[model samples]
Target: MAALQGAVETTAPVSRLHEQRSYDPADFGVPTGREEEWRFTPLRRLRGLHTDAPLPGGKVTVECDPAPEVTVENIERGNRRLGTAYVPADRVSARAFTSFAEATVVTVPRGVVASRPTVISVRGDDPAGAVFGHVVVELEPLAQAVVVLDHTGSATYADNVELIVGDGATLAVVSLQDWASDTVHLSHHHAQVGRDARFTHTAVTLGGSVVRLAPSVRYAGPGGEAELRGLYFADAGQHLEHRLFVDHGERNCRSRVTYKGALQGADAHAVWIGDVVIRAEATGTDTYEYNRNLVLTDGTRVDSVPNLEILTGEVVGAGHASASGRLEDHHLFYLMARGIPYDEARRLVIRGFFGQLIAQIEVPELHARITSAVEAELA
Candidate 1:
């Protein structure tokens, strides 16, 4: 419901962090949930990742498989491409950046098309400690590849991920959060699109005590394209949040974003925030963002916010929409009227809602897993 055409200035020091971008953790201070960005988040469940508390170690295990056309390495933080995609935009992200000594970097050479997907598996070893990690993905000119980040187990974890897509290159990234019921995770993903490049970001969140993921994109050159998609399920007493921001500063760029979530049981909560900004110089831009949330039962809560700011009237088009509500009784009645069982009818409706996005992934194994997870949630 909120939109801004120009920069917003605030008097409070904590409020300024919402607009400031920095790599130093000191610049953000600590969030009190009163700031514009953190108001919807449950900061008390973050396990001190935002404050001066120490970031625990040895709580997470990460493994990666190197592909023939792609190179994966645990490089020192001094690597030139470490922060090329994005810098820390908040306190937790800044803390994560400062805590990790090395970053996992995946690089695809120029003009090379990867034959197989590069998979990174991250699992929590214990639930008592906190973990901080970083990941960087770089694609050279005309390169194409897919990267999957699979996370599971139980722990307090925070991470920063960056993706750099070069001119004419294509990159797709999938982040799956299937954790233990008690796990807590916070992550920030940033992507930079080069001239004529293509980027796709997908997120699947199904577990955790409190999980929040922020994915942002900025055009590095003209004619870039970005697609962002997400799906999540929230159970009783669980909190899930996904926030996205796309900044179009170059000419002739295009972006599309779609996110859908389902919630059931008492006290389950889901939040989605989508923001798109088109600068005055971003002529010939085309963008649309939408979010849909399905409340499957009583006592569950959903908050959806979609915002678009256009500083130029020369842009091709720009728009955003958000919808949150329970399933329609007419849909169920229509199906049951054909002699179909109630349970089967409900399942069909749920599947149909998410089928479009799932099919877009084009990965059968992932699709199966997502459906199975949702079925288990419904059971």
Candidate 2:
């Protein structure tokens, strides 16, 4: 419920890693719920993804229908293109990296524009087994494309996704997590934006037992732009968490982030953590992040934190906003005064709250589907 608009200065030598990124899982200690990173998480529910337990893989399936101009491949661990655009910053991410058997790669050729969006589906068949996965999406120089990533079914899943946006290219990605009620999923998506490229990513998470997602962005050269947006609704006993980081290391770059969520029923929890760091050399960087949460019931809880770190005062502008509270009583009163039933008025308020964000995405089908899903949740 706090908003941070200023910068923080460091005097002595600081760690090179922003959040202690590492490739080896052994570099990270197991979680005991005492560390700052794991404080808000329920560690006992992770089912050994953070520990040394065996990741024998599970009944996980991946299906992709790529555009004619795109190339899709199933690559092994030693593939040259692997790990080129991302690094793991947490224990689960490192574990998913080292344990995933294969990686799915979707590539859009240089200078080619895809006519249709590329669709990829990841589903789990067994809730008892564990799944570790890796996904890579690349757009070469001057290429343009859209990617749709959907997840469903149930399992204990952890994975990492890499997005490479080349120079002067434009890339849009929509990631949807509609898992079953018994599913537990953890994922991290990182984007490497090249010079003058544009990248947009939207995350829609509506169902899960325990889901945690991290999306991050970094610039490879100057003039790159990135936008991250998300929406989620949690029911009783469902926990949804999203953490985002933007590293502005290049000059004249721009980044924006906005996320909104709603919670209902008892014991529903949501967490949002947004961090933006503007380095000293990153002059003329313009960035802003925002998050808002709505509590539809009494037993639900939410935690929203927005942080900004500007190492140099020469930047263009930087700021953030975060707020969490119940629905505005005046808005409801205004609707109820029109002869609308109490329940119908509540639905209208919630719909208007999320409909704005849903319309921001360029995809058409997602707009309708998410609206229908929200209506079902309200019912």
Candidate 3:
């Protein structure tokens, strides 16, 4: 479908559609739950983070284990490479930008393909308090790398992450949230994919009092590809949310998003929002996004919304879908018909739901660990 190929300029912003872009915190103001973006979120669990309360001393300690060839730098606020990939899009992200005292930058030099993953571990300290952090990952042209970000323990944390993959580069990012039940985390992640580059972002959320993560991707040039995958489990009294946006402003770009979640016990809540925009000039764009949720028990809630806006019919393809429901009785019945016990049958169904995405993870150790944790939750 090349109906509108190269027919219009891509820089014009329509005033009717509310755009979520700004470097100033005041532009977003304070979220009072009445705003469309913040309506699904529980602001009370944020512990005054959205307001003017000053960020306390850091309670989360961060350490990086880089590959032998990689370079890790703890830079000051004004470093030249800090904001190249992303900017603050909301009040909390803007606040994180203004509050963080220092920033961490990890650089993968041009054309260096890493053999081992660059792991960054963030652990919470005792006497948990509010914490703010910023991390920037830069990959030069033709570089290939896998970066893992692990979060554990407990704290009230807010952070911003920026990922830049240069032209002809390949980058895979895995971010896991394995926090204690008392922890609350809010984060914004932005990725800029260069010409003919490939980028994959995988997020796994398992434990938290309230966790909301926003991931946005934009192409710096045409011929870029982006794949976003996520898996989450919500237990009793837990809230987990994931919001994503993929902007297709460049021609010949492609994106695919798939996220699955399971909920059990009372008061478990999960929210997923997938948004994709295809501009008139982006004629060769191909995009699809979908989210699925399985409810394992009563008193659980799930919200899934998929939105697609296409300014031109010239694009190759564009579509979105969302589904939420309890496990299929036929799936469990099929296993039980084979003489398997009821508990084991239920577990198998949940495992099968997540297994497909888990298998996509390239790290064997992380794959085994995540499978074990999912089993523990089912137990």
Candidate 4:
């Protein structure tokens, strides 16, 4: 973990992270090679990996053209608006908020409608130390914006991001991860929604030696809405995991999540765990979650768990679903009999599984890019 620490210390431009509590790997629970959640996961994959350390310069090359519709700013507001919150104090004594000294803050002004999608590219060049980066996004009332974050690096690193949506605002965020083969990636995303606000998040993971993504979202005000979507593909000897939590704390709030993944080749594993909680006071709330996985090879494995807890029966709707299996022979046979090749038929099915989530995105360019990425992975 010294490598991770060094990255955060030197690369992170924000200054306030030092004030917040720090996080230790043991705080989340060590992999016993026996726990149900860690059953399908291969903890041995992380053996001999470098410890988490800080990056040298805390400088990452961002490669994306600026957009005219959105405004990107830098902030060090000494406020804990975007930082760690869910970690138990007893297990971890890390700061709640750590600002990257060279952080980028994006703000969408009230009543503004961004026509083009904004792209933020974070590229890491250091191979020895961890790189800590923070991005805080705030949307004003009645504003509509679309933001895309792309993370690419040559070395192993850890990144943290925080997002806040104002009342009556609409923000769609799409994150794409394409790391190098020797990279180890860990990301934490926290979002807070206000009254009548709408937040939509879609994540696509395509590359990395070991990748863990955690997205925690909460509806803190009335009439807030959140939709979360994710897709991942793991090939030979790769390990990918996605963990999500959605909390409804206000009345008349709504949330929906759908995530799908595909694993191929020997020793490849993918895991998805989704948890949704409706508090006692959150009446008239509606929430639903679903997770599905497609195993492409005999040696590949997938684990999916969808859970929901409701405290009040007065809520409108609450449900969860999970499924993990291989491609259906009947469907493949039907396509093959119709003159389509078996390989192409399988590709079509995999595309359809992920296409469901990509279709929900409103940005045309982003949708095309995600679709193309998925197709390329299949090819």
Maximum-TM-score candidate: 2
lDDT of 2 by residue, 204-230 (tens): 999888889989999999999999999
Off by over 4 Å in 3: 1-18
Residue 77 lDDT, candidate 3, scale 0-100: 74
Task: Flag the better candidate by TM-score, 1 or 4.
Answer: 1
RMSD of each: 3.8, 3.0, 5.8, 8.2
TM-scores, one per candidate: 0.94, 0.95, 0.94, 0.83
lDDT of 4 by residue, 299-323 (tens): 7766666656677888999988777
Model 1 alpha-carbon miss at residue 43, Å: 1.1
- Lowest-scoring 10 consecutive residues by lDDT in candidate 2? 1-10
Worst 10 residues of 1 by lDDT: 1-10
Point to the candidate with the largest lDDT. Answer: 2
Give the lowest summed-lDDT range of ten residues in model 4. 1-10
**What's the count of clashing pairs in each model shown?**
0, 0, 0, 35
Q: Give the TM-score of candidate 2.
A: 0.95
Per-residue lDDT for 218 in model 3? 88
For candidate 3, give the lDDT: 0.85
Q: In model 4, how large is the Cα lDDT of residue 146?
A: 84
